[model samples]
Target chain A: MIQTLEQISTIAEMRVHIKEARRQGKTIGMVPTMGYLHEGHLSLARAAKENCDVVVMSIFVNPLQFGPNEDFERYPRDIERDRELARSAGVDFLFTPEVSEMYPKPMLTNVSVSHVTELLCGKSRPGHFDGVATVVTKLFQIVQPDYAFFGQKDAQQVAVVSQMVADLSMPVQIVPCPIVREADGLAMSSRNVYLTPEEREEALVLSRSLKQAEAWLYEGVALRDIQERMIAMISEMPLAAIEYVEVLRYPDLVPVEQPTPGESIIVALAVRFGKTRLIDNLITSI
Target chain B: MIQTLEQISTIAEMRVHIKEARRQGKTIGMVPTMGYLHEGHLSLARAAKENCDVVVMSIFVNPLQFGPNEDFERYPRDIERDRELARSAGVDFLFTPEVSEMYPKPMLTNVSVSHVTELLCGKSRPGHFDGVATVVTKLFQIVQPDYAFFGQKDAQQVAVVSQMVADLSMPVQIVPCPIVREADGLAMSSRNVYLTPEEREEALVLSRSLKQAEAWLYEGVALRDIQERMIAMISEMPLAAIEYVEVLRYPDLVPVEQPTPGESIIVALAVRFGKTRLIDNLITSI
Candidate 1:
């Protein structure tokens, strides 16, 4: 007999279950996602299941993280398919709260990280990381998980969250899972649904360019030269509109002229395939 | 045999003690203070002991909550005396982390509450509530108490902290204990150490004016007229420099021209006694 997955919508109901789980000595691992479940989110859920006695996945497309002109309204969401995917992945609990349920009134609290959030997507999107940090804090308080899993596809987000937990002395471990990619080498993203067929085909340039940059770095090419080459490669795709392409120190995200020996650095990029903006990154050690 | 109070000076050690307490099915109550324990601080500890199986009081002078020109450097501290007071007050654990221990590095994460903080002390001491909110968050995460006790003498601080816990869904109840006052009606404060004999004598005017305002309110006086009379009474004190005297709704701190019947309102004031700035408030329902 297959055990049915539990769907929790309210914070109070979720806490009741969490209290009982704690009483039974169950370790909870959580995977927070903005649903439209792709292979990447499933990978995070699978990672959680491996590490914890109970796996909780929260599918909330938080409006706090979106800019005024960004795709908050049209962001892809399919709870029906997401529930099926979560069930197949062996997720024990799925927390799917409505926007009103999560935020009953105007939220007056804001959680923000300073230096680490000053680079990457943070630089482009002004208050994005503040929004992410605030909502993630609320979820962490609600679930009180032992370990939380995040996809490295959103490298900056992982870094910001790691910094927040450390700085706040929050009592959970942050496990950064590897970026999950499609067979065609394109990084899996919920926004991929918005791409035209041609734009979808051209989107593979994002990853291919990063792969080439990784090879160049291994061959002892200067970091700036590799970054320039990667940008040039992606520019060749007609539909690709490059937002940023650069090499920065891992986690800290400070710009580097040369890779320090044995230190990890990330070659991350955000490029718009027509109207859909996609981000991908590769972390390699010198 | 008298039980000796355990003094925990490190986060790791505190966590270990808290974990052991949790395993034994203890309900922990916390009172966070900045040393120089007076009757006000002791009252909170007593309240905590009454409500919880274990009472933990933390006494660390938080520099974050002080402005550059504020009394951070000269703030009073006496751990030896504090330990004796904690023992007498029935506190089980006393956490006394050094500034370096609490903030090993420059903190990157800041927790801030908006709107409700914009009035009262928040208006005069900018970024003061943000610092208070951040440190309190760190303390709450470290202690993980079943209930947290706060003195209502710092009414705005209580409001800000209560708002943060509710907004963040933090799993601790905020218990606001009544303000412990001197026989002469001056509110107890650690900063009272900074008061000269003349200033100490003059400080009684603050509470006296509030009492007059309360009587006027009882007589169906308008809120604005009561505020003007209170300000005038305080102005008569030769050494007093009034920062603000406000008549606002309780908890929310929104300005109110007149109190709604059956609703609580606060008549709050901040004044400088020579170099020492002190705050006090009276909350009553119409």
Candidate 2:
């Protein structure tokens, strides 16, 4: 049976829970998410359970991480439903803190990684990574988990957090799990629920283009040629407005001219289906 | 008998000792200091012992915090003598990580606080506060203590760290102890060792003027009058080259015109005692 943490508002309450887990010699793993329990999030929870003795899942729809026009208000949250899913996924502790509970005052500090942060999602939303870095740092302090799991679907986010942890020498291991996808190869996202049937079909183009790019790389196609083909494929979808289709170095997420053998490569794209923006990525090692 | 943690060459080794203390349900307190420990450093350690179950003293003369032309190489270090003093002063762990251990690679990330960082020592040493903020952030992550102690001697450093912790929402409580002074009233600093016998005697002028300013404030003297008198006294000392003298808010260290009741006032001055620059402050509440 999984335990639900009731109003663990302060850092003190979180510490109490963490201390009890430590007393029992439990290795705690944390999966921090914005609450819309998609399979992608559940996959992270499952990975956490496999890696540690106890799994603490934090559901926080961080307003700071969302831009003014972004879907913060409409970001789907079903705590009761998510709780059941998390429990079934082997999460030992479910921590759901309110917005005011997490940020009592206006936040003044911002953590930013140079160079890498200027690409991908960062380009579309300014100050977004700063918000992500600040909130993640607060979460890390509150949870103090032995291992923190992040879905590789947020490929750029993984790169940013990795750079932050390494740069700050934070005392926790960051585990990036593989992205979970649907039967037709569309990456699982909580926003998928917002998709109309037509938008859902258009969203398929995101993964389809990524798959095409991956196959091209396997056949030793030029990096530029694959990128051009992905752009052409994404542009053809009537409902899809392509934000970016990029092939970059893994972990660092830097644009590479050619794929180096044994080096990880990431083919990532962002597409808007009507007003709803969705992101997906496929990482491979050549 | 006090348990001394000697021969900690790496940050990992130092973390192990602190983590073990935390595991035993003991609250850890840290007093971060450069080597050549004096009464001021001891006062912070004593305060830590009073409030926490374990006291860890870090003795790293952080080079990043010093300007290139400043005394990085010639900065005083008497580890053997400091170790004997730390052992006698009830310190549980003495963390003395080497330069290579602290900065293994070229540091790119720096923490900065807006507005408050632009005054006093920050104005004198360009990029000094950024360096201080970076090293302190690193120390906070490494120590992960319940409380970290700092002396009032470095008033600006205290203010900077406080702002950094508050802005970042760092988990540790910052415990600022009063500045410990010599019998003759000069503030204790490792750099005091650099002062000549003639210059050391002249350094007393810093404390004398601050005391005079405090007395004037008690007698309802105007803030401007107090500043003028203090500047005059410092100028009278042959070995003292006046840097800057001002009356400011306590802790925030911002320059203030008139003392606000219950808002503590700080009379601070910096003077070059021959080649060694020294700073001292006196706090008073209106």
Candidate 3:
């Protein structure tokens, strides 16, 4: 059964929806998305449904996170399709606010982390994480969720949000789920739809390279050697334009030379499949 | 009836205190203070007690806010005295965590605000607001207050915190209470105890200048004329070295060239009474 909201246009409206849900003694779980729904998002919704009484999925293709040259306009968005998928995933509430509604005017405020934000995806995209941090913060406030779910596809983003929650002492708990992948082992992402048949095949290198690195690490390969091998393999792919490839501490996402035993390490990368950017990561205790 | 919480040295212990209070269905209000409590802090504590079922006052002289040359070491410390003052003011809990306890080893996170933090007190004391923002963010997380009380003594601080809450969408409401003053109109502060007899007399000029500005504004004087008069008055007090005397929009605390009706204006000043620096403000709707 599909439930449709009146399309909340302001933070106040969103609050009214959450307030009513809370009055029913319902726990809210939020899944914030940029609006092109796929299995990855559905997986998050299912998790939210299992953990919370009411699940709210926010479809806002946040413009603040995109640079001038980045695909803010061309970003994949299908509200009707997303709504149908969310309904099937057992999502109780769907919040799709307009860009103007989210950012009524040019915003003067921004949330930023010092060192962690300057690495990985942040190294290439200047204000990208700042944009992500700002929007997620706004969503957290609007939804007032008990728990927020984010797919591991954007590992750096998950790490960034975790750090933000810890640093700012935001009350919401960030639940980072495992990466949802396709049959070919490629991470499920809306950008995957942007790939041509040829580019789609080339995008496989992202996950494959990380898997290879993991195998090498298990076989006693050093951290620097593993990263060098992964970079070489991705560089060899014709359609895979590597943006960044690094090994960092999981959760904190800080660059580390060697992983300590019991410490989680994230081997992550961002690659361009045609004009679309795809990110993937492999987490393991080293 | 004075109630004293045994000094909790860990975040876990502090959370237990908060959780136990909540289990009993008590709403928490927090007053984050650096020890060496004065009338100003007691006023905030009283406000917190009136507003919340449980008042948890944290007394930690945050080192991060102090510059290297600043007197962080010599600032002050009278936790026993502070506990008495808080208990007398009807506080339910007093959290006095050591710096090491609050900032356990391997602390790498900091919170900062842009634009708003770059002016006023932030201008003279670099990274000062960042320290305040970071520690306050931690306190908000640790105590999880329904309402937090701050004094108008630190005018720019109230402005920075208000902006932080709006920007981060923090769940807590920030209450800015009126500045408590001495019979001679000198703003009461923890640092007031550091003032010598001669310096204490000169400190009266800070409030006197503000009163002078208020009288001029009441007489239908322009903002510029009032500022010029106050600046001249402050300059005459030899021991009262002026840092800044500017008028700004109230609450939002934005600097304004012309006053607007219905919008509040704050005439704030920071001056040195001997080696001790003091700040004060008078907030009024124009």
Candidate 4:
């Protein structure tokens, strides 16, 4: 892979270019993203480059995924900087479709996955998963890549998308990359820019408490006690408003009443630092 | 394309065979059916033979599409006879996945299309289009055919599936096949076996009423009057229990109050002959 990255916008062009690459028997790996390049997004591009002959990165701030009150209009976007980063990261094709091109008319079709969507972030945001499922489905159809990558930072999103692909028998593989974090342990997110310096420092308590909870796992504390302890620790930071701090089973996202043999648990958190919400999780096996 | 027809029953084998066919640059066309082997199904296979290098016929009586009171158990099946019929129709591959193979687990994913699904058969059958969309989506993913064929006899079904493919941007093209009828004018259906010889003759009122309504469409009569006339005609046949006789806009399935200039209308009817329910429709551009 050279630095000769081709930028394709329209779905028609993307299909035509992909068909040519497919004719030549090139394997495709896609990293779907909302623009404004971050080190975490670049990490996805790196993984795709390593696995497949061609890497396509899509950068559209999907309106469908944003709630009415969420940051749809204020979401960060830098196409020029994104282009530079993608070129240096050895992206073969960059797809950046206009919103109108993506949805010219009112969308009447929706892809919904049950059971997996009724928990986590799906609890607070009513239609978030529906939007995510719908857009991710459209992207999968448009790209038709052999492998698609997502960040484990959004663990529930990964779970919902994986369920959709599996239940539908979609002919694509979903690759979950580990969450990238700051040196201070804050998970990298586009919304992190909304935090003040003081709020950012206070947000470190989220990871600190999670790491402490990881220690409690080996001690065989009850799941509720562990959750209460983490909640108490976060309450010390006045700037951090805890939305949810849950320790649930992996992939299924079901609440684990007690630790069992060979069971895996994910200690997940969602806390707001001023207006920005940050999420992070730590996985452990018992 | 050849005299030798191959039969596949598993998803793994189907993928392997289709991948190889696609690798050789063969355009595939699929005909999805419930496997009773009638002239209507043969028409789809013949159209597939004319358009594509390989024709695949999938025979699965999807239980998800049937209601609790509906006849799912006694739907009909004869693999040996269907194999011979598919072979005679020049099918390159016959996919007959077992129910367990198709639904190893309870399906958690559902694909839904709005507007088009709220009327016609959708009004009478709740969750019917949802099942159709879900199963059709799974088939499209498993086969990844270049084109898929459906009988226009189920005009509402064609509309639902077409909307789903368009909304999801699935890569396969949907081909609508013309409805093939018997010499006596009753529409060909797998459930027609349930009809007794005398009941079969009475069932002709379904097509007869629809054909009469088609004439009224060009005569500039109000759409409601045509629907009322169709209902009266079907009422005369005691064996034919009328379910619905609606004249609606094409694709959208919206009820039309009056005839519009140069607009397409679908004169649709659903009637039951004894225990079997039959549906038929005729489209005319006025």
Model 1 over residues A155-233: C-alpha lDDT tens digits? 9999999999988888889999999998989999999999999999998888888889889999999999988888889
TM per prediction = 0.98, 0.92, 0.90, 0.98
Residue range B1-286, candidate 2, lDDT tens digits: 5466464667888878877876787898998888799888888888888899988889998888889889989999999999888877778788898888888866645666656667677788887887788778788888888899998878888888887787666778998888888899888989999989999888888888888888899999998889898888889888778878878887777777787789988787778977798988877798
In the range B197-246, model 4's lDDT, one tens digit per residue, is 99988988887887788788778778888888888889998887888888
RMSD of each: 1.1, 2.6, 2.9, 1.3
Off by over 4 Å in 1: none
Candidate 1 backbone collisions, by pair: none
Residue pairs with colliding backbones in model 2 are none
Clashes of each: 0, 0, 0, 0
What is candidate 3's TM-score against the reference? 0.90
Please list the residue runs of candidate 3 whose C-alpha ends up more than 4 Å from where it truly belongs after superposition: A1-10, A16-28, A249-263, B1-9, B20-26, B105-107, B252-255
In the order shown, the candidates' DockQ scores are: 0.85, 0.51, 0.38, 0.83
Query: Residues B167-241, candidate 1, lDDT per residue (tens digit)?
Result: 899989999999999999999999998999999999999999989989998899998998889899999999999
Candidate 2 lDDT, tens digit per residue, A1-286?
A: 4454343446667778887887777889999998789898999999998999989889999888899999899999898898789887888778787887777766645566677777889898887887788788878877888899999999888888888777777888999998899999988889999999999988888888888888899999888888889989888889988888888888777888898899999888888989889999889978
Q: Per-residue alpha-carbon lDDT of model 4 for A45-81, expressed as tens digits?
A: 9999999989999998888877889889998888999
Candidate 2 docking band: medium
Best by lDDT: 1
Question: How well does candidate 2 score on lDDT at residue A55?
Answer: 90
Question: Per-residue lDDT of A1-286 in model 3, one digit per residue for the tens?
Answer: 4454344556777788876776566788999998899999999999999999889888889888999999999998888888788888888778887887776655656667656777888888998988898888778867878899999888888888887777655668999898888998989988888889999888888889989989987887888888889989998887788888888788777767778889999898888877888888999986
